[model samples]
Target: MTRTSSAPLRSPVAALLAVLLAASGVLLGAGGAQAAGYRYWSFWEGDGKSWAYATQGPSLVRPDDGTVQGFRFAVSEDSADADRPRHAPDFGAICADTPAKGGAKRVALVIDPGTTEDAPAGEKPPALRTACAQVAPDASSAEALASVAKPLRYDSSAMICAISGYPKSGCGEQVSGDGSKKDGSGKPTDDASASASASSAPAADDGDSGGGPSAGLLLGIGAVLLLGVAAVFQARRRR
Candidate 1:
């Protein structure tokens, strides 16, 4: 005779608690911003499982974090390799306060500032491969658990040309095309904007000299007030 063994159970309470903790750390809704116009194409296996990719206009709020749209490849419990937990695919970014359109979930995502071909219609093509693209479903057909873009739907040569003939042809791959690219000021577009302000410090310093020590003294006092408030909050938290 042989004895049978049972696997350990992670308590339902523990699972719920873990979920709550993670949820708390996540920023809440940004409204329906990832699906409105984007198309989702998905691949799946049994057990009603699915995986997806999506592409869309620059997000008005939440943005992509990397090369692909604001999402990642996900593996389910039955599909994962040894020791990996089943996680829902996370490509759609959401905002903490966003509400679902047609009951789909909302999340904060990093926006993918795609190449020149994918850049926003009116803006200068980003010099870098990153920026921001918010997404929201255009219809209710996007309730599935996994999907990826079909390419033809959002590619410049497809939809754009269908409406505007700007791409000058239909969907076709660009020579040497790969998402891993860098053309911006070597920084995310937003960061470069911030750095522009930061780099202006020397000019600001020079401009202030004319105001002499008195202006510097007033600025110093203002800074002290801000620091004082910050210190108070820090001390209270520590206490």
Candidate 2:
């Protein structure tokens, strides 16, 4: 004679595993949410007269004596690939070092031509600084930098990087050492769509500034699909 036991059957460990895996999938989906529009930095180093691209971000590089650090505003290829072709910056012109005149600080700045439409109205750039300008009549970094009497010497302590928006609210502000500056009315001191952030190095610049969806999203989707497959397997095992 066979006797029936009153004990109930337990669910397989696979069911528990499946729940944890699903929770992990949810967390993975949130990884890239911090991306507030993908603007990043590209670094360069200067020979006191000429410049070269940097292999690593500024944070990894600590300039010794006489070493000059340089940075150029690099937009995403999507933004840069249009008619406006930006050449690598000219260090001799952009980083032109001049002795202080009349005990006033010498500052040099370059503006990108593509960003001219964003420039605010009613304000003119200061005249005393050195600017290396592009030959084109249109607005350009070289053309903007050219107006100044002399380009400021590159400093490891402080660097001038380009910020592309006003109120300085995006990637540029994040990189700015001084942070955002407000006027009497709490409006941003910078009215130009494209402005410079004179800040410290060793902070290192970011990469891949474009804000579009690309390979990363595709890979993420694939991962989610794979996780779904795993959940299906766990369900089958529970049955």
Candidate 3:
């Protein structure tokens, strides 16, 4: 009696499954890896009452007279997770001391350097304060900021990275999410008691910057597909 060889058939099936499992892992890792959180200044515009995430960067926005511009530095996944200025956007209170000019516009600016917890290692946050900028009627928000917060720093892409040399270095660096939240909830805390002392600054102007699959991800997918095809071909050949 001749015994049929089952080993050869089992080997190909096992190899095929192994290849498929590896492919699944590659796909999962490519898609599920935790995103790196960013530490950067989030821009905002405020009505007299509340803050709204700025849709346009300061360089592009021509803030109207009495417009309130806000900047907050923090570790956040996106603008939605960013902390708003601690104080309310009271344009009247911020610009009260500065009289209006005939040929210029006045913009109230709020700069929050964030808590020490969110500051870069070995760095401390600057005091939070407001500023009233007197700029040309058509001047952009950036111009308005420069009027008070001079010596502003910007990255190669023209993105505002720092205001008044707070951090001193780095531009939108990636950081872990540990201790990322302020007050346990990523919402704005209305610190109405904070004084509206006049100060000034400039900050980041881009929206959430992201990209598609990386080169490594594409290479991993290609390799997995190739191995799967080879295993299937070998299994059929052994028949």
Candidate 4:
């Protein structure tokens, strides 16, 4: 009598189990790497054509005449994912009404409070607007912004929390990737209805913020897991 050995089937089963465990490890690692993001205002500078992510903070960069400064508030992982101002950086159009001053510089400002989705709970975003600020020749971008959008709110670290008292409170707080504040029921919370008092403190520079893993990274990991699952099923059938 010839006996068929079960070693072949067992070997494939063990290999499939190892693959499944490795896939779980990948998923956990990916989830940890793609943790949370921050909701804050991202500063930008623009030429006559397009906006550029500012390398230096608004307080450090000095704006020249005809320069355009932009401020966008949204939930972002980092500067790469930051939402830019809605309007274009049109210095000629923004400062067209205001005549140039000899002793002062003309800097156009584009302020976008972001969409309703990005606004804090129980809060509405202010309309996107443009203003031409006339400031001293050596005024920094932050000063230029303050010249127009006054009553800015700052945190203990000097980070700008609210512009024109929009959100009422909170400074660069960490939120879900989608900018939602969820409760135990997995429903969004509406706890942003706080006092509208503005802070009298000076705003500070928000330097380059950090980010987490991208969506593509998570998707790729999921695909690998699915392929592994398929391999496990195939091995079972072979057994």
| Candidate that would win on TM-score | 4
**In model 3, which runs have C-alpha deviations exceeding 4 angstroms?**
1-35, 179-239
User: Per-residue lDDT for 135-223 in model 3, tens only?
Assistant: 99999988898888867887644566688887787656655436432223222112200100111112222432222345566677777
- Candidate 4: tens digits of C-alpha lDDT, residues 91-175: 9999999999799999999989999988888889989999999999999887888888988876544456777886787666667
46-74: candidate 1 lDDT, tens digit per residue = 11123322222221212212212222111
- Better candidate number, 1 or 3, judged by lDDT: 3
lDDT accuracy of residue 118 in candidate 4: 84
Q: What is the TM-score of each predicted model, taking all chains together?
A: 0.19, 0.31, 0.62, 0.70
Question: Which portions of model 4 show Cα errors greater than 4 Å?
Answer: 5-35, 181-239
Off by over 4 Å in 1: 1-93, 99-104, 107-110, 115-123, 126-170, 176-239
User: Model 4 — TM-score against the truth?
Assistant: 0.70
Q: Tell me the lDDT of model 1 at 216.
A: 48
